[model samples]
Target: MQNIGKIVVVAAATLSLAACGQGAKTQAAAPAGPPVPPSSAAPAPQSKGRECAADDIKTTGKFGEKPTITIPDDCDPPKKLITKDLSEGTGNGAKAGQKLQMNYHLVTWSNKQVLDSSFDSKPFELNLGAGEVIPGWDQGLAGIKQGGRRLLIIPPDLAYGQGGRGIEPNETLVFVTDAVSVPAG
Candidate 1:
């Protein structure tokens, strides 16, 4: 009986660690968007894939599935954050301290394996400048308008660094995102 009890405790502990993104992620809260007020103006079209025109990474996927990414096998990570606009938007751009709903795809630069993507599930909500996400996100996401799509190529220093979640230590990360909404403060 004592041996069984120990086994159960160890199993529970391991499960707990895995639940914390084992270095992956947490289940995001339900999707929420800006409260739209009825108007006569037609809504602007949302941006989609156009990755290769802007950066070295290439991606293929629709709005609701995991995207496939292709990067040059020998390409090196840039020293600074690379924010490439895939498409433009007319809505208010994201800013610090505002709540935002965004669709994102994250892949590690080392092995080119996808780590996370909102396109697989509900759009992720982030409180800008709140430290809920990595520093690269807060800095790279700034100035992008709602309805815009962008590519953020974040170097290892701006990402998980040595204490990597599921990612390798000091891994650079690549993210393609659509700035869906920024609700009023």
Candidate 2:
């Protein structure tokens, strides 16, 4: 009976961790002009495959607002994690162990569909490098300054290895994150 209880606890913990990504959706085409409103439909698939690099992924919009992320159709996944600062922030840089409050937009590279976002609701909070989130977030977010906006291109190993609840297996991830606050440490 005690062993069964322990198994249940472990299963519950695993489920909670895998809940990071909500669901799977296909990629879409990029919007032409201003950022697309939240009500816009998903983009259509394109033929060209863009290399997995910061230069190829386009982000538009001011910091602290919901930005537009346009991933090339059939984007080749990177072998490792890539972090690029779209806008630099002042003050101390973020390090492991410090708590961070942030708003982010996440999309899967394979389908270019939005997997999750904190812009419409409350900001997401996490302790850096504490295994509270995916390995990509832990490895990619280090040294980002408060108030800065960054782009993280994460391959499968850094994200969900075998995939999770809603994420497809071995799917690459693209994120646009704004550091809402990271207390001085």
Best by TM-score: 2
Candidate 1 lDDT (Cα, 0 to 1): 0.75
Best by lDDT: 2
Candidate 2 local Cα displacement, residue 175, angstroms: 0.3
**Every candidate's CA RMSD:** 17.7, 17.0
Over 4 Å off, model 1: 1-54, 61-66
Per-residue lDDT of model 2, residues 1-185, tens digit only: 99999999999988876764332211234334444436675454443555667888999987898988998644566778999999998789999999999899999887788989999998899999999999999988899888899999998898887778698766889999999998886
Estimate the overall C-alpha local distance difference test score of candidate 2: 0.85
Off by over 4 Å in 2: 1-50
What is candidate 1's lDDT per residue for 1-185, written digit by digit as tens? 99999999999998988877544543344434433436974454233333223357787754334557676654466667888877776677788898888899988876678888888678899988888999999999988887777788887788887645787655778888888786642
TM-score of each: 0.65, 0.72
